[model samples]
Target chain A: MSSSSNGNGTPILELSDVHTYYGSIHALKGISIEVHDGEIVTLLGANGAGKSTTLRSINGLNRPRQGKISFQGRDITTVAAHEIVKRGIAQSPEGRRLFPRMSVIENLEMGAFQRSDRSEIRGDMDRVFELFPRLHERRNQKAGTMSGGEQQMCAIGRALMARPKLLLLDEPSLGLAPIFVERIFDIIKQINDQGTSILLVEQNALMALDAADRGYVLETGRIVLADKAAALKTNEQVRKTYLGET
Target chain B: MAADASVPTLANRLQRPSVVGLLGVVVVGGAAALLLKNLTVAPSRFFEVTLIGLTTGCVYALVALGYTLVYGILELINFAHGDVFMLGGMFTITYSTHFFGLHHGQGPATILIVFATLVLAMLSCGLINATIEFIAYRPLRGAPRLAPLITAIGVSFIIQDIGLAWKGPNYITAPDVFPHSRVFSFHGVDYGWNKLIVVVITIPVLLGLLWLVQQTRQGKAMRATAQDKDAAAIMGINVNRTISFTFLIAGALAGAAGLCYSLYVTTVRFDQGFQLGLIAFTAAVLGGIGNLPGAVLGAVLIGLIQTWNEGLPWHMPGSDWTQSIVFSILILILVFRPEGLLGERTPEGG
Candidate 1:
C-alpha cells in the first residue's frame, strides 16, 4: 500500500495505527489514513471489510482499541461522541438512521443539536433545503414515509446542519436506485466544492472512485491498496476484483 | 388496507372537539347533579372522600412523570420505578426520624427538614435506578424487545424483595413533621394546610421539569436520543449518558412523590410501591407513554375521575373497586386510542 501524504498540507483528520474491536471480535487492524481539507476520500470495500468500523471509530461510535484520532489539531481519540460533534465532525451513518418519528424539518433541526446560535442553524437549514428541494417540499412530512432517495437527502441535509468541517458519510448510496445514486454523488461533490471535506465509504467502488479525489481499497480489515482515484480506476488489481474487469 | 385507511378517519372523528365537548358536558353535568343530591346525606364524608382522591391523584401524577420520562428515552416500561418511589419514602422516614428526630407541630422547620431529606432520598433513588439501567438494561438494548421487558420485571421484583427483606412486612408511620394546621378557608370550605403544602411543592417541581425538558440543550439531546440512538450518537450525543440522565430524572421524581405521599398519608410500607406503580403506569399509558404533557394531563384527568367517582351519590363505586375501574378504563383506552390522547403517530425507518 502507498504511504504518501496528499502534499497539500497537514490533514484535517488523522488516524494513526488504529485498531478497533466489537466485543471480542477484532474489527479494524492497524488502519491509518489522513484526510486533508477540501478533498473527497473514499474507502472502498466489500461487506465486513471494516469500512463502517473506520467511520464509526472516527465519530466515537466505536472507539479504537489502539491508536490516536486527531481532528483539526485536537487529540480526540478518547473524547465522547457528542463532544466530537461539538468539535465540528458530523456523520451520516449507514442506513440513513434518521429519526423515523420526527418530521423532515425536525430531523434537520436535530442536526444542529450542538449548535447554540439559532440564526446560523436556520441559515444552514436553508442551505440544505436549497441543496435538496424535495426535502424542502416535504419538510413537514415524517422522514420514514419518504422514498429512499428522499431519505438520503434528509440524512445528508441533517449532517450539513452540524456545520461540520469534516463530514463522514457511510454508505450514502446503499439502497438507492441508480439515478438517485448519481444524484447523491453529484451532491457530495457539490458539498465538497463548498469547502466541507468528506470521508465517504461505499461498496460501489466505481462510483466512489469516480467522485473521490483519492481512494483506499480495504480488504478484510486492512488497507490493501491506495492511490489517486483515476489511477486506481485503471489499476489492474482493482479492475480484476472490484471493477469486475476481465 | 381498506380497514387501515378508514381507521384514521374514525379516530379523527372520535378526537373531534365537538365530540369531546358533548362528552364533557354530559359527564360533568351528571356528576355535579349527583354530588349535589349526595350533599344532603353527609357533607363531611363526601369532603373526606374528595380529599383522599385528590391526594392519591396528585401522588399518582408525580409517580407518572417518572414512568413518562423513562418511557420517553428507553421506550421500555421501568417496572421498578414505583419501588424506587417507595424506597424514597422509607428513606425519608428513616432519616427524618432517626437523624433529625422530627415531630408534628414543629411548623416550617419540620417542613424544611422533611423537604431536604426527601430531596436527598430522591437523588439517591435516581442514582440507583441509573445504576440498574447501566447494569441490567444497557447490554440488552439491541436484543429483542421482550428481553429488556422481562429484565425490567425481574429488576422490579428484586427491588421489591430487597425492600421487603430490609424493612419487613410492617406499615411504618412517617414522623409527623408538618403541623396539622388548617391554612385557609374559602366559602365554608376549610382547606387543610397539608393539601395546600403538597400542591404548592409539587406544582413548581413539575413546572421546572417541564421547562428543563422543553427548553434546554440537554433536553434536545434527550429528544434526539429518543428518536434514534445511532443517529444521535453520530451527531455526537453520548447515548448512554443521556439514557442514564433520563433514568435519574424519572427516579428522582418518583422519590419526591413518595416523600409527599408518606407525609400526606402518614404511613408507608415496602408494598405500597406496587399499587402506586400500577396507577402511575396506568396514568402514563393513559396520557400516551412517551409524551410528557400527555402524562400530566392523564394524571390530572385520572385524579379528577377518581375524586368524582367516590363523591358521586347514586351508582358510586366503593373504594375497593376504584383500581378495577381505573384499570378497565386503561384497557379500553389502549384498545381504542393506543397512541394515547395526545400522542402523534411516529413514522418508521428514519
Candidate 2:
C-alpha cells in the first residue's frame, strides 16, 4: 500500500535509494521515504530491522554509502552529524543518549547550543517545562540521576530546545512504563499539532499508529509496506507481524 | 527484611579485619607516624617546607590540570601533555634570553619580558597541542581506545626529541627575572617574591579554567561532550572542535606552568619533561584522573610529601626518594582510594 501524499506541502525531508552500512554489515539497502511538512511519519519495525539505521543515516551519524538525503530541498547526505542539527533537523537518538552528569536544564541548554537567542531560548525552556512539569521540578538534577521515564522527557525536551523544523525521534517510547508510553504518544501528537514535522521510530505498533499520520513497515534493511496509519493498523501483515494480533 | 539486616554493612565489613584492612592500616599508620615524628622536631622547618611546598605544588597543579582536562573530554591520557609543558618552558627561556635579551635584575623590563614570554609560550604551545589533536588523535578516534593512547606516547617522544635538538641534553639556566623581595619574615624564615609570583599566576589560571569548564556555554559543551561524545554531537555541539579547545586550554596551562618553573626553579632541561611529567601524571591519578579539583589537591599533596621527605629535620629520606615516594602513592591510590579525595566514584553509567 502507498500512503496518500495528499494536501501536505513540500516535503521537509526526502531519502532516495539510501543504502547504509556498518562495517561489513549492510544495514539499510536502498530504502526510500519522505516526510512532508507538518506531518507525523512513523517507521515501524522490530529489532535489527534497520529503523534506527534509517534515522542515523538521515542525521548523518551513519552516512549512506549510496544515495541522497535532501532536507528542505537541499542535499544533506554528506553533512556531519552536528551540522545536520544546524540545518533545522534534530534527533533525540536511541537510548536517550543523555549527558549523564549534566543537569536537566543544562541538557536543554545543550540542545540550543547552535542558537544564540538568549531570551528566546529562555522562553523555550519555559515552554518545555510546561510540556513536562516533572522536568521543571528536577531541572537542576543530573540527567543520570533521574528515572528512565524522566530521562526520556529530558531527551525530548533537549531536542525541542533546538527549535527544529523537523524532529527525528528514535524509540521515544522504548523502556518507558506503559503510563509514560501513553503520555509520550500524547506529547508526540501535541508536538505535531504545533507545526513541527516528526519522523518517529517505534516497536509499539498500536501506539505509533494511533499517533502517526503515515507509517512504513521495515524488515531486514528493506521497507515491505508503506501506507496511511489507519491502513497499517488494520493491515493483515502488520497485525500478524508487529501488532501481535495473529 | 530480618535476614537482609544480618548482612554486613560497609562499616561492619571494615570492623572484621581482612588483608586489605591490614594493608590500609599499615600504610596510613606508617604515614602518620612519619609525619608526627618529623613535626615534633624543628616545627619552624616544617613551616618553611610547607610554604616552599605550596609554591612548587602550584606548578604541579598547573601541569596536572592539563592532564585531567584532556582526560576528562577524550578519556585519552594525552601523554604528550608533559612534553608540551617542557616545550613551553623552552619557549619561555628562548624568548626571554635570546629574543628579548633579558637579564637578572632588569627592573620594569623584567616584568614586561616575563609577560611577553608568558603570552608567546602559551599561544605557541596552545597551537602545538591543538595541532597534535588534529594530527595524531583525530584520525585514530575510530580505532580502539588503546590506539590513541599509544599514539599519545609516540607524540610525546617526538616532542621530546625536538626539545633535545632545540637545547641539547644539558640543563639550561634560566635568567632570574622575578623580583626577590621578601613577602614576610618570621624566626628567620622569609617567603620571597619569587615564590609569591608563581602562586599569583597559578591561582588565576586554575580559577579561570574552573569557570570556563563549569559556568560558560562552552564549558557546558565540554562537560556534555565528556559525558557522551555522540550525544553532544546530537545536541549540535561540535565535538571535534570542543576536543581541540580542550587541548588548547590544557596546552596554555602547560605554558603557564613552564613559565612558573623556569622563573622559580631557574632551569630547563630537555629530559626534564619525562621526570616532571611523570610526577604530574601521578598527581592526576592520585587526585582521580579525570577530576579537575582533584588534580590540584593531589598535586599539592604530592608536593608537600616530596618537600617534607627531603627537607625535614628528622630521619628524612632526602630528595632522591622523591620520585619513588610519589610513584608509590600512585600505586597505593590505585589499589585503595582510586576515586581520589575530591572525586566521586561513579558506577559505569551503562
Best by lDDT: 2
How far residue B234's Cα lies from its native spot in candidate 1, in Å, is 2.0
Candidate 2 lDDT for residue A188: 81
**Model 1, residue B3: C-alpha shift (Å):** 17
Q: What TM-scores does chain A show, candidate by candidate in order?
A: 0.96, 0.96
Q: What is the TM-score of chain B alone in each candidate?
A: 0.87, 0.93
The alpha-carbon lDDT assigned to residue B45 of candidate 1 equals 60
TM-score, candidate 2, is 0.95
Residues B1-350, candidate 1: write the lDDT tens digits.
Answer: 00133445435656767755686578669857777766657676666666656666777888898988888788888888888989888887877887787787676687678777877878888898899899999999878888998998899888888888888889889865555567765435566767766777778878988888877778877887987787898776788999999898888888788778888877988788988898888888888888887887788778767776766565677567779878976886776667777776443111
Per-residue CA lDDT of model 2 for B104-145, tens digit only, reads 878887888888889999999999999999999999988999
* RMSD of every prediction: 5.7, 3.6
